[model samples]
Target: MQAPMTAYKRAWGEASAKLIRKELEKVRQEGDFSEERIAAALRRLGCGRDHGVHLGHGFYSVHTGVACVSGRVAKDEVTSKVHGAYAEPQPGTGPCVENRGGH
Candidate 1:
């Protein structure tokens, strides 16, 4: 049997999809837009604002759906972080990686 989907997850997925579609449309509409400008536009589309979507410890996602963007962080911030508004991680120690049973 398949597992049921949670309301939060469903909503998040929908919103994320919408954001992506909107971004694509924007690109098609305006060819010269930069990544930062596109991200800022997404944030304005009910996604929230920049600086609120931190991925934790200064890491952030430049898009949506990849990370949870609720509570202190706004939806737009989450989107911006995913879109490359933040600095890249240092070489050695990367973000915490989850270990599965494999390998």
Candidate 2:
């Protein structure tokens, strides 16, 4: 049997914030929404203007207890305030990615 992919999945299918940062660099978009256009979006998300890390096509920031990336996959996609945009992530919902601070 196979597990279904959930929205909780990272944009590039990786869990490490470091790895996702690498993949984010390859994304590119048209004018206006260019790689440099993430600042405003970050501010709009209340993540602050300084937290923005323009990664070609999205904005990313990792703080003490929060991480976020904003985007528009396509014009046809519904644009909305997507806090916790994926879903409520619960422990035991899937396999562990990294055992952080575990004894």
Candidate 3:
């Protein structure tokens, strides 16, 4: 069994995911899939600094205060999800697993 989720964790997890989705939408609209541009869009979530935000191989993983938000970004489409304490390992060379503290 797993420990109960803290209120803080639950709140931040949702908030971070929501922000990630919005930023990814901007990414789709902007047509700039560079790491710098994506990171800039997610700046409001306090990514790209202490909390790591890794972007590569068409995938991105951001370690927020309470959860890891991972996503795929394309020139015309973007998708995201908030990782739980132990999400399944992501394929390829993406940082989702590590960023989520899974490995």
Candidate 4:
């Protein structure tokens, strides 16, 4: 027979999922809910995924549509942070900063 706790766990998981989905819907309605935006936010949480579909090495948040971690980072977060496929800005690829300084 299945453990009694198994049913409880399943129920909690389902309920949590529903709540998360609802929050995600709210976030989507607020503003740009694109993958890029979410990925950026996830970076702050020390989580990221390539292609915005595959879980790299951290947790992904559907509610915020962002990558997230369960708790505070314990060490050098910069080197530890994961970058999504398009998360990191390609050097010399951006049009903002340039050698063309205002003359």
How much does candidate 3 score in TM-score?
A: 0.68
Model 1: per-residue lDDT, tens digit, 43-62? Answer: 66645333333233323233
Give candidate 3's whole-model lDDT.
Answer: 0.67
Give the top-scoring candidate (TM-score).
Answer: 3
Candidate 3 residue pairs in clash (backbone atoms < 3 Å) = none
**Candidate 4 residue lDDT tens string, 28-69:** 455645545445555544333432222223323321122211
What's model 3's lDDT at 21?
Answer: 84
Task: Give me the overall lDDT of model 4.
Answer: 0.32
Kindly list the per-residue Cα lDDT of model 2 for residues 33-54, writing each as its tens digit. 4445444434333433244332
Question: lDDT per model, in order?
Answer: 0.38, 0.32, 0.67, 0.32
The total of clashing pairs for model 1 equals 12
| lDDT (tens digit, per residue) of candidate 3 on 1-103 | 1123477776786788787888778877878888778878878656775665677766777766566677789976788766544344444323345423244
Give the residue spans of candidate 2 off by over 4 A: 1-31, 48-54, 58-64, 67-72, 78-103
In model 2, pairs of residues that clash are none
Using lDDT as the yardstick, the better of models 1 and 2 is 1
Instruction: Give lDDT: candidate 3, residue 74.
Output: 90
**RMSD each, Å:** 10.9, 12.2, 4.8, 17.4
Which candidate comes out best when scored by lDDT?
Answer: 3
